[model samples]
Target: MSEKPINDLSPVVIALALLIIGAEAVFQLANAGLVGGPRGVGWRMEGIGMFGYSPAVLERVLVQHDFSPDILWRFVTYPFINVEIVQAAFCAALTLALGKFTSEYFGGLKVLAIYFMTAIVGAVIYGLLVEGNAPLLGGFTPVYGLIGAYTYVLWLRLGQAGENQLRAFQLIGFLLALQLLFGLIFGGGQSWIAELSGFAAGLALAIPLAPGGWALLLHRLRERS
Candidate 1:
C-alpha cells in the first residue's frame, strides 16, 4: 500500500482541531492579559456563562418553560470552550487523532453530525440527570464521542477479521480506569455523566452513520427475530 502523505489531513479533522485549539488560545490569551484588558480575566468565565450548558439553566428552560436562544446554542457551542490549556490540549489531541480516521470512514458531514449530536445528547442527559449549578464546559465530551466512533470502527474491523471484538473496548476501558484514578486522587466531578453519555450517543449513532451500518443493523435484528 502506498504511504499516505502527512499533508493529506482531512479538512474535517483540521477544522475540529482548529475550532478547539483556537478557542482555547483565545481564552488563554485573554486570561494572560495579552488581549482584552483586566476585564479579559473574566472573559472565559463570561463565555462559560453564556455558552456552557448549565443544568440549572436547562431546568429553568425545560421545567419552568423559560425559553431562550442562548440555551439552545449552548448545545453546539459548549464543546469549543475549555477550562484551561491542559484540558483543551487533551481534547484537541483526541479530536485530531480519532477524528481523522472517523471522518475518512464516515465522511465529514457524518463526523460533524456525530460530534454535535453527541454534545447535544450529552447536555440533555446532564440536564435531566445531574443536579447542581456546575455548568458543563470543555471539549472532552465530544472527544469521547469521537472515541466512541473510533471504537465502533475498530469493533467492526475486528469482527470482520475473525478477532475478538471485545478487544475494541480496551481504549474506553483504559480511559475509564485513568479517570477513576484521577477522580480518586483529585476528587471526582459530575462531568463524567456528560462524557459517558456522549460516548453512548456516538456508539448508537454509528449504527446509522457508518457506511452500510443501517443495513447491517437491520440484518442482525432480522436474524435475531
Candidate 2:
C-alpha cells in the first residue's frame, strides 16, 4: 500500500483504530499498576472473558435456542480484546493502512460498515466450524475484511487497465500463507477460518456497499449472459 498520511484516514476509521489502541493502552496501564489499582491487571483477561467470542457460549445458546444481548454483542466486541501489545499494534497498523485505502473507495461510513459486518460474519463462521474453548479475540478478522475491500478495488482497477484480475489476489494469498506458517510453528487453532470467512464476506459486501457496485455487477452479469 502507498503511504497515505494518517490524516487522510476517515474519521470513522480513525475512531476504530483509536478504540483498538486505546483498549490496549488501558490494559498496558493496568498491567503496569498505573491505573485500575492492583486488581486492574486482570482487566485484560476479564475483558476477554466478557467480550471474546466463544464457540462454547455460542454452542450453549444454539442448543438451548436462546438469545442473549450479551452473547450477541460479543460478535462486535471481541475485536477490542488484545492479548499482547505487539499483536494489537499490528492490528491497528493494518486497520489504519487498509482502512484508509478502502475508505477512499467506499467512504468512511461504509468502511465501518464493512468492518463490523465482516466481524460478525467471521464470528458466526468460526462458531460453526471450530469447536473448542479458546475464544476468538483481536481485530485481525475485521482488518482482513478491509483487505478484502482493498482487493476488490485492485481487482476493479486491474480489469479497467486490461490486466489479469487474478493478480489482485496476491496480497490475500501471501498473507494467508504467512499466517499458515506462523500457525504451523506456534500450533494454533482454527481462527484462520474466521479470517478467511471475513475476507469472503467483505468481498460479497462490496457488491452492494461499494459505490455503483450493484449496477456494475449487474452490468457484468448481463455481459456474461
Candidate 3:
C-alpha cells in the first residue's frame, strides 16, 4: 500500500491520543493509590466508591469547572475515561488505521471531526437507551467511529469500477455479519448499539464526501443537455 500523508499521523492527533491515554493512566494510578491497588481498582469497578468513568460525574465536573456543556457533550473528555491498557491500545490502533484512510480521502481535520462527533453520538445513544446509571465506559465509542470511517470508505469505493465495487460490498457484508454475530453472542447493549450508530454515522458522512456522491448533480445536468 502507498504511504499515507503526514497528517494521517499528525502530531496534533497523535499528541492528543497520547495525552488522553496518559491522563487515563494517571487517573487509574490515583484511584489505585487512594483505594488500594489493582485489586482496589477491581473493587472500584464493582462500585466501591466514586469509581469507574462516569459520564454523569464528568458532566458535573465540566460544568462546575466552567467548561461548556456543549463541549462536554461533544466527547472532548470521553477519550480520557478509558484507563485500561487493552482498551487504550485498541482505541489507538483503530484510530491510526481509520484515521489514515479517512485523512487520505477527507483531510485530517474532517476525519478528526467525524471521529469525535460520531463517538459522542454513540455514547449519547447508549446513555439514552440503556437502563439507568449504566456507566458508558471504554474507548469502544471512538473505535466504532473508526469502523464507521472505514465503512464510509468502502461505500465510496463501491461506486468505483470492477474489483473496488466487489471489495466494498464484501466489506460491508462482513461488517454487518460481524455485528449480528456479536450481538447474538453477547446480547444487544452498549457495544452493539454504539457499533450500529458508528456505522450509520460513517455512511451519512461519506454520502457528502465521496466523489461519485455528487454524480447525481452531474447526471441531472447531462439530462438537461
- The segments of candidate 1 whose C-alpha lies over 4 angstroms from its true place after superposition are 1-7, 218-225
lDDT of 1: 0.86
Order the candidates by lDDT, highest first — what do you get?
Answer: 2, 1, 3
| Model 1 TM | 0.92
* Least accurate 10 contiguous residues by lDDT in model 3: 44-53
Task: TM-score each candidate.
Answer: 0.92, 0.93, 0.66
lDDT top scorer: 2
Candidate 1, 1-225: lDDT as tens digits: 887785566788789889889988988898889998899989888888888877886787778887778778888899887888898898888888888889888988899999999998898898889877788888888888888988988888776676777998999999999999999999988889999999999988998888887897676446546
lDDT (10s digit) by residue, model 3, range 98-173: 6777667777776777776777777666655665555665556665666666665664455533234346556556
Each prediction's Cα RMSD?
2.3, 2.7, 6.0
User: Cα deviation of 17 in candidate 1 (Å)?
Assistant: 1.6
Count of clashes, each model = 0, 0, 0
